[model samples]
Target: MLALLRPALWLGSCLRGYHMHAASTQQRGDTSLVLVDEARRFIQDCLLRVGVSPSKVRCISEFLVVADYRGNYGSGLNRLDYYLSDLQSGHAKVGAEPSIISETVSTAHVNGNSALGVFVGNFCMDLAVKKAEDSGIGFVVAQQSHDIGMASWFTFRAAGKGLAGIVMSNSAPTMMGPNSKSASIGSNCFAFCVKGEEYHFVLDMATSVKDIGAVEWAWANDEYIPHGWAANEGGLSTCFPSLALRTPLLFPAGGHKGYCLSAVIDILCGVLSGAQYATHITMDQNQPSNLGQVFIALDPEFFLPNFMERFDDFCGRIQNSQPADDSEPIRLPGELERMHMNYVEDLRAFAYPNSLLTKYKEVAERLCVKPIELAFDRCQSRKSF
Candidate 1:
């Protein structure tokens, strides 16, 4: 679970115990290929230092690492700061647990009790998978949680077990409404996953054209964002990452379609679960998010008995289709994630940007946790993963 890795291993590919300071001094001009185990341990140790439950730390790490491995870099280590900030601000309660408030044969409502979102996500996803096995379908919702990291973490777990999975969560207002001057809507996100015989399809995305993390990355690298991605305080499309970050009026993906889709997810995760929706979920400013979420699992065994065969047929046809550009073959939803997984496994490590690595190292220095092992010299590896 990345900004940890899906194929994380404790010992392999490179030397260990190498600290950031030992590698570089002032200019963070290049990336590092870090041992997966070292990175995972670093995240856990940092969270532990911040008072997270030992057992719950694994879930949070899994969420982050998976996102990074799946190419959702914005949700990966790029987001570690958000979690640490919450704990440091005393807004996120340490070691809090979720409780089920009500349930039926195929549905349940939960109260996260202000726990870190990953803990809540783990509990709810487990319940959903179990219920789907027993009843053919499971639908669970929760309120009072924090950020759940990535929706793919929940769906990936279920799809890996041969079930279809769906997840959605509401968020702070980070997108703009049509004609609005500043951000006035949430970037509500959702993910869907399903497994076939030889493939699994995963779709994880924000309703907005892009998420805040993507914007942050562009800004950090001193690059202009793509046109149509977001707007500035003046409600005009702007390429300036700093301006976009300042006002944060992300353009809805596909215009009205994206807006409506986010609204629908908000109703499911926020309204139904009694959690704050849209603007009610505050941005930064040291306040608990109290976010709402929905997790669902459906068993193929109970329906579509030829599910795998049908999926193969569908894939074969797509695979055979001719591409307009010979170099750019069509790809399925989770293909990039699978490719990243294999790339890391082959190298036995994860690649990280110098900017992010510097921040992570600073975190370790500040918290007194062990530094995550990393390699900066070109002799260590020929290229970034």
Candidate 2:
């Protein structure tokens, strides 16, 4: 009888090990794709099937995947679930077309109608670039848009069109008062793109010490957030009474300077647009309310002749500036992202956590898409970093 039980126990352990192996392989599947065009096509088809228009779907898929290809998973493919949730909850209307709500000789306001931000943002930026080309300058404001991917993408669009672009957005309240006990502000972000001589310069940053997504990711991974990294007991401000609180206010990057810019962005993106501000608005995420965004573009010709040439010269000087450390060279804002993109091209896929892999499988199942397979051959080669 004991021998019989031993065999059964051994079988059970082997089954558990098999499951673990499958989970591990699924998570570690390579993200670098030798066949990137095929992957893009696959993603586009998937998005279209879910009700996004073909053109819009193409742009959205590219925007999301660019982040993945750059190793910014927090803002990359990992965010698809959030978009799906918004679609299912009626917070985002798939296939909704945006319209110009107001306009001036040099300015326009757009109503996104709860459309995906990627499409709406691209549309607005394109309009801005066209206007700038004709009028020497253009300004655009959009409301009722859902979370747009990286602001740099929009700025780059403007740069490609020979215009300087500035983008801003107000996110759900995630910060607390400085030295206080209450939440008082939003996680605001700002970005800029300017056509340089050799390469365009792009700068993008969140006002918070780190993005809210970073904090959320930490929580998901069962990691403890550092003090001054989250809100305190009441979530009213950026202060904490003790270190044991589950959440604490996130400090602003660059201290008061970032805090000030955050306030400015909230005013422009939220107040000027007549949208909810700071803690008053709701996020697309199922969590408590808080969200907003803003974008602005400028034509360099408005200020100077041979603007692109001058800009390039300025960037060249900055690039050649002495490095603070000899081991690391100075780098422009978008240089890291560019390097990451190149790295992914050589290595086929990204390495994700086992838990994230499981979640991806679950999401795929819910959408009726084929589950991602668990095998090394299905993985992409890694680029030599």
After TM-score superposition, the amount by which residue 251's alpha carbon in candidate 1 deviates from its true location, in angstroms, is 0.6
TM-score of each: 0.87, 0.80
Report the C-alpha displacement of residue 216, candidate 2, in angstroms: 3.9
lDDT per residue as tens, model 1, 1-385: 2223212322211111111222222223344567666667888898899888777788778777776666566787778877888888856778678999999989999999888887888789889998999999999999998888778888877887789999999988888776666665688889999878876678888999888878876654445677788888888898788889987789998988898898999999998999998787776647765899999999987898898889878877887799999997887877766776776676656666667788888998999987777744323433454
Q: Residue-pair clashes per candidate, as listed?
A: 9, 31
lDDT of 2: 0.64
Kindly list the per-residue Cα lDDT of model 2 for residues 1-385, writing each as its tens digit: 2222233223322311111122232232322122345445545655665777777777777887786675455666567777777766677888677789998877888887778888778878888888888888778877777677677788888888778888887776666546655557776878898866687677877887666655544433333455455565654333222332354467787767778889999898878776678877775454322245666668777878888787777878888999999887887777776665665565444434445556766877777775454323453322221
Off by over 4 Å in 2: 1-49, 217-228, 231-248, 284-292, 379-385
List of clashing residue pairs for candidate 1: 1-64, 1-65, 1-66, 2-64, 2-65, 2-66, 3-64, 3-77, 4-65
C-alpha displacement of 188 in model 2, angstroms? 1.1
lDDT of 2 at 109: 83
